[model samples]
Target chain A: MAISEPIVLPHATDEVRLARTWAQPRGFWGWFMNVHHTAIGVRFMVTSFIFFLLGGVLAAMIRLQLSRPENHAIGPDLYNQIFTIHGSTMIFLFAVPMMFQGFGVYVVPLICGTRNIAFPRLNAFSYYIYVVGGLLLWVGLFLKTGADAGWFAYTPLSGPQFTPGKRSDFWAQMITFTEVSALGVAICLATTILRQRAPGMTLNRMPIILWEKLVLSFMVIFAMPAVMVVSSMLLMDRTINTQFFNPANGGDVLLYQHLFWFFGHPEVYIIFLPGAAIVSTLVPVFARRHIFGHLAIVTSVVATGFLGFGVWVHHMFATGIPQMSASFFTAATLMIVLPTAVQFYCWIATIWNGRLQMKLPMLWVFGFFFVFLIGGLSGVMLASVPVDWQVHDTFFVVAHFHYVLIGGALFPMFAGLYYWVPKITGRMMNDLLGKVHFWLFFIGFNMTFFTMHFLGLRGMPRRVYTYPPEMHWGGLNMLASVGALFMAAGLIVFIVNFFQSKARGTLAGPNPWAAGSLEWATSSPPPDYNFTELFTVNGREPLWDNAPNQPIVSGVRDDIPEVLITNSLDSEPQHKDEMPGASIWPFLTSITVSIAFIWSIFSPWGIAYGAIPVVITLIGWLWPRGHSPAPRQPALEGRWSK
Target chain B: MAELEHTVRKGEAPALIWWCMFGGPFAWACDLGFSYVLEQHTCSTGHHYVLHVITVVCAIIALTGLAAGMAAYKRVPEEANDHGVRPMDRTHFQILFGMVFSIAFTIVIIAEAVPRWILHPCQ
Candidate 1:
C-alpha cells in the first residue's frame, strides 16, 4: 500500500479499466439502483419536462376557457382546480427542478472536474422524491381531489372551514416533498463546489456559473425552510385542529403572509439566478473571450442573493401594512435592480469586447435579453406601492410575473438546454429547427403576455372563472389564447429536435462549441469516470488559457470510486475520499416517505405509523458495508510531510 | 499521517476575510428583521424614532465591514487587477468582492432609512 508516483498506462487500457470499474448495473433493477450524477440529472430533466407539458396543458385550458367573454368551456369548480394546479406545477415541479436541480446536478460536478457529485446516493434519492411529489399533485388533479386554493394556498381560504376536503392537504404535503428533495440536492451541489474542485482550480479560477450555483445553493438553504414550516402549519391547522392561521383563535392571517412571503420573495431569485448563470456561462464562450469584469459579476450575484431576501414585504404591500413598512420594502425592491443591472452590463461589455457569434444557443440568449428586460422594467413599476395598489390582483400583475418567470427562467433554460445537449447526448441538434423554436416562442410569448397588460389596465381581474361581454376583454383574451397555441407549437418543434438529434444528428466531438470550461475538456457524453486523468487548471477558461498542455492530476485510483478532496479557498489537494456507488435503498426510502406523506392527508396517525418503515429504510440506506481497502501512502513525500 | 501534514500546510482563510465578506449582510439582515418586528411596537407606542436609531446603528456596522474590506484590499493591492490562480489572487478577489458587497448593502440600508424619515410609522 506504499504510495508510489502514478504510472501512466496506455490510453486504451486506461479507458477499459476505468469503464469496467465505473460501469452501472444492467437492466431494469439496475436503473432504479443507479446513483451516478449524470443519470440522476437526466432523470430530473426528463421527469420535470413531462410535468412542464402537463402544466402547459392546464395553462392552455385556462386560456381556452377565457378566450371569449362568459365562455363556459370549463365549469368554475374545475377551473379553480386547473388554475391552482397550473401555478403549483409550473413553479414547484417544473421551474426549480429543471433550472436549478437538473442543470446543477448534471453540470456542476463535470465543470468542477470531479469524478461524481458528492453524496451521489442522496442525489438519486432526490430525483425519485421529486418524481413522486409531482405524481401526487397530478394524481390528485386527475382524481378530482386537486388543490383549489391557488399556488400560495393562503390560509382561511385553504383552511378546513372554507375549502374543505383533502385538496389543500395535498398541496401542503407536496411542498414538503419538493422542499425535501430540493434541500438534498442543494447540499450535494454546495459540497461538490466547495470541497471537490479539481486541484488548483482556486476560487479566483472558478467559472461564473459555479459562483452562481454556489450562491443559489446557499439561498435554497436559507429560504426553503420558511415555506416548509408554513406548509406544515397549514396542514396541522387542517388535519390536527391547530390554529396557526385561525383568526377566531387569536391566530392572525397576516402571520401566514409574513412567513410565506419570506420564502416566496427569495424563491424568485432561487429560480432566476440559475437562469442568470446560464447567460453568464454562454456569453463568454460565444463572445470568444474571457468574460469582462468577472469579479464584478460574481459580486453582483452575491449582492442579489442578499437583496432578494429583503424585498419579500413588497408582495404584501396592498394588504395594508403601515406606510413606513411599505416605503422600506419599496426601496429594498428598487435596490435589487442595481445588482441585476450590473450583471447585464458585464454581459453586454463582454459581447462588445469580443467577436460575437450568433450560434443557436446565443440566439436564445438574445431572446432572454428582450423578454427579461421588458419583464424587469414592468417589475420596477410594480415595486411602487401606488402602482401596485392600482394593479393588485389584476391581469396586469399576471402579465408582470409571466414576463418575469417565463422570460427569466424559461428562456435561459432553453438556452442552456441547447448549449449543453451536445455534451449530454454526443450529438448536435438541427440548427433550422432550433431557430424555428426560438422565433415561435419569442413571438408567441410577446403576443400572449404583452396583451395582458392592456387587459389588466382595462380592469380585467385575475382568478375569475369568466368575464361579462360588456367588459370588452374578448379581443385581447382571444389574441392571448392564439399566442398560447403558437408557444405550444414551438415546444413541439423543440421536442422533435431533441429526440431526433439524439438518434441521427451530426456526431458532436468533445468540444462542439469550442467552449473553455473543464466540462468541455472531457468527452461529449462524458464517460462514467468523467476523465481518464483528472485535470489541474491554472486559469478560469482552462482550455483556452492552459491549452494543448494543461496539467493532468494522476494518483487518484482508477480501481475505486475515489475523488480528490481539496481545501476550500485555494483548492490545494488534501486527501482522497471514496464515493458511494449505485444502490436501491434511496429508491426504497423515497417510497416509504411518499407513502407516509400521502397517507397523512387522510389520518393523523399516518405519520406515527409511517416513521417505522422510514427509519428502517433509512438505516438500510446508511448502513456501511464492512469492506476497506488498505490506505495508500502519500505520493508527494515533501508536500505530505510538511 | 502524511496527508494530515499536507492539510495542515494548506493553512486556513483568515477570520478577518470571512468577517469582511459576511458581516455587512448579517447586519443588513438584522436591520431588516428587527425593523420589521419593531414596526408593530413603533405603531402602537408612537416611538418611530427607534426605527431610525436601528437603521443608523446597522448602517454604521455595514460601514465598518466596508472599512475592513478596504484594509484587506490595501494589503493585496498588487494583486487587485490580477485574476490569476495564485493564492494572492484569490485573496484579492475575496477582498474586492467583499468591498463591493459592503458598499452595495450600505447603500440599501441608507435607502431603506430614507422611507423612515419621510413617512409616519403608523400611517
Candidate 2:
C-alpha cells in the first residue's frame, strides 16, 4: 500500500513494452477530482447509494402518509410530491443510473480488456451532469415546489393548466439532463465494448455483461430520444404553448402516453438487463465453470433488447386503443417473457449442475429468482387484456414494477457490487454484514410489495395522495410502511459495510474468488493500462486453465504515453500506439456543454451560444500534435479505434 | 494495419449491423414521418399521400442500407468480412444516406402536400 512498495505484474507479453501510466493524480485533491473509471464508478455507486437512501426516505414518507388511509402524516400535495420524487429518484437517479451506468462504467473496460472507458472525459461529464440534475430536483423539493404530477408526470395533470409553475419544469428539464447524461454514457459504453476488447476477446468470447451493456446502450440511445423529444415538447407546451400534448389545440393526451411508455417500457429492461448481466457474470465465476450456455445467454439478451421495443404499448393497455393495437402490444409483452425465461433457465441450469458458492452475492441471486419470478409472473398477468383492465391503475401495478425493478434490478446490482468490489477496491466487504443486508432487503422488499397486490385487488388506486379509511386499505398500507423501514435499515447496513471495508477490511488478493474472467487476470485495483503485457486469451478463464506457469511481465516503461493495439477478433500483436496523457480540457468542455444545456432549457438561444465554446474545445481536443505521424496505430488492424 | 485483422466470424456480424441500422436512422425516420404527418394536417387526402411518400422513402432507405451493407460486405476483404468490419465502420451509411435524402424529400412533400392537406391554409 505504500508509494514505494513493489508493484506486482501478472501477465507478460513480448510484443509491446509494458509500463505504468496513471491517467489520474494520486494526491488528496487528485483523488477528489479523479476522472478514472474506477474512481468515477465508485463515485456513481456512492452518489447513487445516497440517493437510494433519500428515495427510500421518500418511500417511508409515502407509506406513513398512507398507513392509515388519510391519517394525514402529510398533506395530499406533499404526499404526491414525496412519492413522485421517490419514484423518479429511485428509477432515474439511483437504480438504472447507479446499477447500470455506475457498475458498467467501472467494470466493462476492465472486463473487456481495456485500460479505460472509450470516452473517459464523457464518462466524467456524465457523473457531474447527473449530479447537477439530481440536485436540481432535490433543490426544487427543498424549496417546497417539488414536482407533484407523479413520476410519469402524465399530460393534462403535468400540463401547464393543471400543474402551474416551475415544479413540473424542474421535473421535465431534469429528465432532459439525466437522459442526456445516460445517452452520453451509453455511447461511450457501447463504443468501448465494440472497440476496446483485449486481443483474442472476440464478440463471441465477450463476457455477458458486455453484451448487455452493448444492447442496453443501443436501447438507451433509441429509447431515451423519444422521452427527450416528448419532454422537450412538454416543456414547450407548458411555456411556449406548442400543441404537442395539449388536446385543445390539436394535441392529444395520448401522445404523452405513447412517447412516455415508449421510453418507459424499455427503461425497465434498460435497468433489468444490466442486473441480468451481473447475474450472468457472477454465476459463472462463482459456479467455477464457464457459463453453462454463453451463446444462449448472449442471444437471449439480444432478443430481449429487440423484443423490448415492441412491448411498450402494453403499458397503454388501459388507454382504450383499438383492440388490435392492444393485442399486438400484449402479445409483444408476452413474447418478452420468453427471453426472460431463457435466462432464468440458463441460470438455474448453471447453478443446479455446477458448484454453488453460497456466498453473499449468491444469496442475493436466490432472492432475485424468487422475487423476480413473482414480478415477472404478475407482469404476464398484466399482459392479459382482462387482468390488466382489472388492476390497471391500482397498487397491483405498482407492486408488480417494484418487484421487477427492485427485485429484478436493484438486488442484482447489489450482488454485482459485492461480487466485484474487492476486485475494484482491493478490499473485501464483511460477509456477515453482507448477509444481514441481503436478508433484511429480501424480507422487507417482499413484505412491502407483496401486500400491495392484495391492496390493489381490493381496489386501491395508485398515485392518489391519500385514501379514505373506510376503503379498508389501511392495514395493508400500514404493513407496507413497516416494510419500508426494514429496507431502509438494510440500505444503512450496506453503506457501513462499503466504507468499513475500504480502509480496514481484509485485502482481496488477485482472484480471491478463483474467478476466470479476464478482469480477474489482473491485480485487484488493476494498474493503469490494465495489463503489464496485454493478455491473449485462448480459452475462457485463461488464467485458471493456464496456471501458475503463466508468464507475468514486470516493469517496462513508466513514462512515454502509449497504447497496445491488438488484432480485433483475437488478441494478436499489433503496433504500439501512443495515447494522450491526462488533460483538463475535456472537463472544461463538459462544463461549458452543461451550461449551454441549462441555458437552452430556459432560453433557446442559450443552445446556439453554447455551441460556440463546445466547438472550440472539441477542435482543440481533436487537433493533432506535430510530434509523431501516429502515436498509436489501430491495434486490431482496422478493427477498433486507437 | 495489424490491429484490424481480427473480425468476428461470419455468424456474428449481422446482429451488430442490424442494431445500428434500425436503432439510429430507422428510428429517426419514424420520428420525422410522425412530425410530417401530424404537423400541419388533420389526416386529409394530401396528408395521407405525404405520409405514404415518406414511408416509402424510409423503407427504401432501410432496404437500400441493408443492400449496401451486403454489398459493402462483399467489398470487404474475406478476412475482414469473416470476423466483422472494424467495429467502427459499422455505421449504417445506407440508412444515413436515406435519412439525409428522406428529410429533403419530406420538406419538398410538405411544401407540396400541406397546402393540399389543408385544402387551403389561407381559408
Candidate 3:
C-alpha cells in the first residue's frame, strides 16, 4: 500500500490531523535549513572530506621535507606547524567525526527503529560547533600563527611564555570545542542505543554496529572528559595564570601528561571501535551469515573500552613514572590486544565460513587486517616497558601509530564511505574510480609511512624541525617525499570522484548492498521519519528472515506523527511515544554554548557571561510549551507510515 | 490531555509527596556509606563512628521512602501465560531484587567500615 493513498477513517481525531500537518519540510529552503540526520550526516562527510584533502596536503609537505636530511623544502617552523595541524585535523576534526559520529548519527537510529537521534538539536549543535572550531584552527594558520609544538601540544613548550601568542590556545580551544561536541553526541547516541531497540531485538538480537557504538560511546564518555579537564586546565594556565602546569607556581608538567594521555590512549580505541563497527556491519553481509560469536564480540568491545583506560601510561614510558606503574601499564597495554585479537579472529572466522566477495569495501577490510596487524604488533612492543624506553620519541612511534590509525581507521573509513555512499546519497559511487582511489591511496600511504620505521630505527628523532646532513637518511627521506606525491594524487582522485558521483551517478535502490540491516529496508536517502512502517523483528536479519511474512501492524493514519514503542525483549506493540516537535531552541542554545567556550578561551569573564544564555536556552528547550504531538494511529499501518 | 486523566487515589498524593520528601536523607545515607568505606581504608588517624551511624540511619530511612514510592505505583498481578510466569511475578522479582541489592550493598559497606573504625580510634 502506497503512503500517498487517501484513506477515509471511521473516526478522525485531532491528533491525526496534527501529525499530518507536522509532515516534513518540502521546499528547497526547508532542505537548506534541514535538521534531519541525513542532511547533517552529508554535511559531516563533505566537511570532513575537505579537511582530509587539507590534511593530505600537509602530509605531502611533511614527506617532501623529510625526504632528504637538511632539506629546506619547508623551514622547520613551517614544517612543525604543518605536521601539528595535519595530525590534529586528521584525528580530532576529520577521521573520528566523519567515520563514527557522522556514520552513527545518520544510521544508528534508522537501524535501531527510532525516529531520529535521541537529541536532534544537540546533534545539529554538534555539527555547527565542529565547523566553527575547525575553522578557528585553519584561520590561525591563514593568519600565520600556526601552532608548532606538535598535535599533542605539550606543556611548557605550548605554554604561553614559550608559544607567546594564541597559537597553543588555538589548539587547546579546538580540543575543547571538538571534545565537547563529541561528548554530547556520545551521550545522545549511547542513550538512544540503550533505550530504543526495536521490539523483538533484544540485547542478543542487536546488530554489532549498535553494540560497537554503545561501547564507543562509553569510551567517549570516559576518555573525552580527561581531555576536556586537561585542556581546560591548560587554557586556564595560559589565560588566567593558573598553576596547573606552571612550575613557577608549584605545578607539575607531569600532571598534564597524565590527564592528556588518560584521554589520548583511549581516544585511539574510540576511533578504532567505530571502524570495528563498520567492519562488523559489512563483514557479516559479505559472509552471508550471522556474525560468529556475537555475544563474545560484544563482550570484547566492552572489555576493550574498560581496558583502554588502563593503558594510557604506556604512552609515557620515558616520563620516569614509577617502574611498577610503568610495568603495570605495559602489562595492561599488552592485555588489551587480547580483545582486539578476539574481534579480529571472529571476523576471520566469519569470512572463512561464508562466501567472501572481494568487493572494494572488502578489499579495504583486507588492507586493514594487514596494516593494522603490523601496527598493533609494533604497538604491543611499545607496551613493553623496556622496549618503549628505547624508541620512545622516535619515528618508529610515529610509524606505529600511523599504521594503526591509517590502517585501522582510514582504510575502514574509506571502505565504509564507499559501502554507505549509495544509501546516503541515493547513488552509487563509481566502483572503478573507488578502486583506483583505493590503490593509489593504499600504495602511497605505505610508501610514505613505512620507511619512517627504518628512519626511526637509525636514531632519527621525531619533532625535529630539521635534521642535519650526513645522517645517511637522505635517500629514504627523498623516497618518502616522492611517495607523498602519490598520496596527494590519490586524494585528488578521491575528491573528483566524490563530487562527480554526487552530480552524476547510478541511482541506488534501497538495498544496493543486498545486506539485511534495517537501514537498507527503507528508501535510499531515507525519509524524515525513517521507516515507512515500524517493523517487528523475528530474527537477526528481519528483512531476510521474515521476508513476505515480515511482521507489521497496520491501522495507523499517516497524517499523525507517532513513534512506536516495542516490547524491549521482543518487538511488539506497546504504545505510541511522540517526541517534542523541532524548535529553534537547540540552535539558540548551541550559540550560547559556543559563545561561552570562545569567550572563556579569551577571557575568564566570558564563562560568567556565557552561562546566562546557556541557562536560558536550556530552559527554553526543556519547557514543554509546544503544540501537543499528533495522536497515535493504529500500530500496523503506523509502522510503515514514517 | 483528557486521556491522561488517570491520577493517584484521592488519599495517595500527600503520602507519595511525603515519601519523596525523604529522598534527600536517603541520598545522604548512600553518600556516607560509600565515603565511610573509602575513609576506613585511607584515614589512619581518626575514626568516624558517628558519621557511619548517621549514614546507616539515613540509608534505612531512604530505603523506607523507596519502598513507599514503589507502593504508590500499586500494580496488580494478572493471569499466567505460556511464557511460564505471570508478568506480576517478574515485576515482583525486579522490585525485590532492587531493594535487596540496595540495602545489602549499604550494609556491606557499613560492615567493613565498622570493623576498621573500631580498630583505629580517633587521634
Instruction: Write the number of the candidate with greater lDDT, choosing between 1 and 3.
Output: 1
Which wins on DockQ, candidate 1 or candidate 2? Answer: 1
Q: Give lDDT per model, in order.
A: 0.87, 0.72, 0.71
By DockQ rank, best first, the candidates go 1, 2, 3
Better of 2 and 3 by TM-score: 2
Report the poorest 10 consecutive residues by lDDT, candidate 1 chain B: B3-12
Docking class of 1: medium
Q: Pick the candidate with the highest DockQ.
A: 1
Model 2 CAPRI quality: incorrect
Candidate 2, TM-score vs. the true structure?
Answer: 0.81
Q: Which candidate is the best by lDDT?
A: 1
Per-prediction TM-score: 0.96, 0.81, 0.80
- Please give, for residues A1-642, the per-residue lDDT of candidate 2 as tens digits: 001112233223433333335556667656545567777787888888788889988888788778786576688788888989999999889987887789888888777766677767677778878888898889999999899898999999999999987788889888987898899889889877766665545555567788899999999999999998888888888767788887777889999998998899889999999889889988877787877876567657876776677677788878776453455456556657877898999998998888888988888888888999999999999998889999989999999999999888888988888888998889999999999998888888888999999999999999787888889888888888888888888988998999899989899987888887778878888876576554544345556554444432232233544444444443343555454545555666766777776676577787889899988877876677635634343332333222
Candidate 3 residues A1-642, lDDT tens each? 112222223434343354354455557655433455666777877888788778887887777677766778788788878989998999888877887778888888888876666666677778778877888788888899777788988898888888887888888888888887788789878867766666555545678898889878888887898888888888888999888888887998988998999899888988888888888888988888878877567657766776677667787878865453354455556667877898999999999999888888888888888889999999988877777888878989999999999888888898898888888878888888888888888888788789889988898898776788878888877777777787778777877887798789999989987898888988887766677665665556666665465545343334544555554323334556565545566667767888898788789999999999999989987887745765654443443332
The Cα error of candidate 3 at residue A371, in Å, is 0.7
Q: How far is candidate 2 from the true structure (C-alpha RMSD, Å)?
A: 8.8
Candidate 3 chain A lowest-lDDT run of ten: A1-10
What DockQ would you assign to candidate 3?
0.04
